[model samples]
Target: MSFDIGNPSYGLVFWTLIAFLLLLVLLRKFAWKPIIQALNERETSIENALASAEKAKEEMARLSNENEQLLKQARVERDTILKEAKELKDQIVTDAKVQAQTEGAKLIEQAKKEIDDQKKRAMAEVKNQVSSLAIDIARTVLQKEFEDNKKQEALVADLLKDVKLN
Candidate 1:
């Protein structure tokens, strides 16, 4: 090993400097724009994903609130329907009671009318029987008084004519 510090290789040094400069020029021209564009696009995409996540969270919260409100409204509607049904039931019971009372009154009136009709018919029958008894007694007394048949016949005709004229 000899340390010849004084000798310098100028050609080799010049060639090395040229190769380094060419490599720098090639990377700057062909690769720098595309790589930098890729990095920027990645950053933009991450920002878009974060924004979408926040929007989804807000929308879900709003939808949950709406669901709760709808449930409350349904409960109110159900209560209203139940109240109306109870009122209807009460009204129906009252109507039934009134109808029963009216029917009872009608039946009582009909019974009274039947009793009055029966009483009138009974009175008429009694009067007819009394008249029949009187006629029978008169006929028996006339038969006893007249022994002769021809004389009795003449007396009956004359009495009947007199009664008709009066």
Candidate 2:
């Protein structure tokens, strides 16, 4: 433990400088190449990892866009189907209304025809009854008039005069 900072030994200093130079030369020849190669390999691996991350980000963005497009297509198809169903519903309602009106009109026409037929039959029956009553009244009046001979003879003379005048 004799540390003399002021009184240094020249021979020891000279040997220490030589040993340091030798160590520097040996490290440069042996350790520096391996260390530099390892650093370069680490830098290349980092670059490859960064590139893979960027590619994955791009792929995620592309998939998100595809999913958005699919959702939009599905919405459009749903709207189209709903619109078609509405149109079909309207068409069916219109067809049903038209059919009902046509049926009502046909029934009305049939009822009118039936009423006309019944009116004509009633009028014909009334005319036949009136004609038969008139004939019966005329036969009864002629029977009463023809009962007495003298009166019947006088009536015959008058009917002959009336016929001759006609």
Candidate 3:
């Protein structure tokens, strides 16, 4: 047989067309069905992944905002605590100073009272000594005057005449 490129036999052409149609139907039923199903599943998975990524991004943003709020609240609480601590410290210092001043005043008052008491005691002692000395001198003068009783009698009469004249 000779090689023919332009035209072939009718029976050969008909058989070839029948075989191609059979192959196309078989591939569509077996191979193409699974391929199309796999492609659909891949598309669904890609969509799911994209949705998950979007949700994760939204969650991350929400968490970031929550963290910022928490940080701000913590900072406010810290500042409030610091302010309270400073106030407490100032109050303590003021109370301590007041207590110290009160104690000092009490001590000064006690010292003044003690000084007054000592001065009174010293004055009493001085008065007692002076009175004792004056009594002793009066006793000595009386002893000397009584030794001259006859002269003391004449002197007594003159004292009585002087008293009557007054």
Candidate 4:
């Protein structure tokens, strides 16, 4: 028998159909089941990785917010400390000024008292010198008057006449 190019025999067609069906059954059992199972496992792993990435992103956002709040709190604390330091500095300056003024006033008063004391001492000394000079002048005049015998007799007679019995 001669083989035809376009038309096949009935026996050959029947055998080809049986062989195709057998190949499909063998591929399903050996390759198709494992391939489908592997694809399902790959899909599940991809989903788990996406979930983990989302969780990490949320955690980073929360951390950023916490850090900002902490920075703001630190700034507030720093400002408070600076304000207290400024107030303390001003108070110290004011106290120093007051103390200096008080000391200056005390020194002025002390100086005035010292001057008054010196002036009083000087006046006392002048009065003593004047009294001593007056006594010396009176003694010199008496000595001159007593040197003349006739004046001395006349002075004695005047002094005796002025002495009267009370």
Superior by TM-score: candidate 3 or candidate 4: 3
* Better by TM-score, candidate 3 or 2: 3
Q: Which stretches of model 3 miss by more than 4 angstroms?
A: 1-16, 150-166
Judging by lDDT, tell me the better candidate of 1 and 2: 2
83: Cα error in model 1, Å: 1.7
The lDDT per prediction is 0.87, 0.94, 0.94, 0.94
Error of 4 at 4 (Å): 9.6
Cα RMSDs, all models? 8.3, 3.6, 3.3, 4.5
Reference-based TM-score of each model: 0.56, 0.70, 0.79, 0.69
The model with the greater lDDT, 2 or 3, is: 3
Per-residue lDDT, model 1, residue 69, is 93
Q: Write the per-residue lDDT of candidate 3 for residues 32-103, one digit (tens) a residue.
A: 999999999999999999999999999999999999999999999999999999999999999999999999
* Candidate 2: tens digits of C-alpha lDDT, residues 1-166: 5768899988878999999999999999999999999999999999999999999999999999999999999999999999999999999999999999999999999999999999989999988999899889988988887887888999888888878532
TM-score-best of 1 and 2 = 2
Better of 1 and 3 by TM-score: 3
- Model 1 lDDT per residue over 1-166, tens place: 4445587577766998999889888988888878888889989999899999889989999998999999999999999999999999999999999999999999999999999999988988888898888889878887786878888889989888889653
Task: Please name the candidate that would achieve the greatest lDDT relative to the true structure.
Answer: 3
The positional error of residue 56 in candidate 1, measured at the CA in angstroms, is 2.3
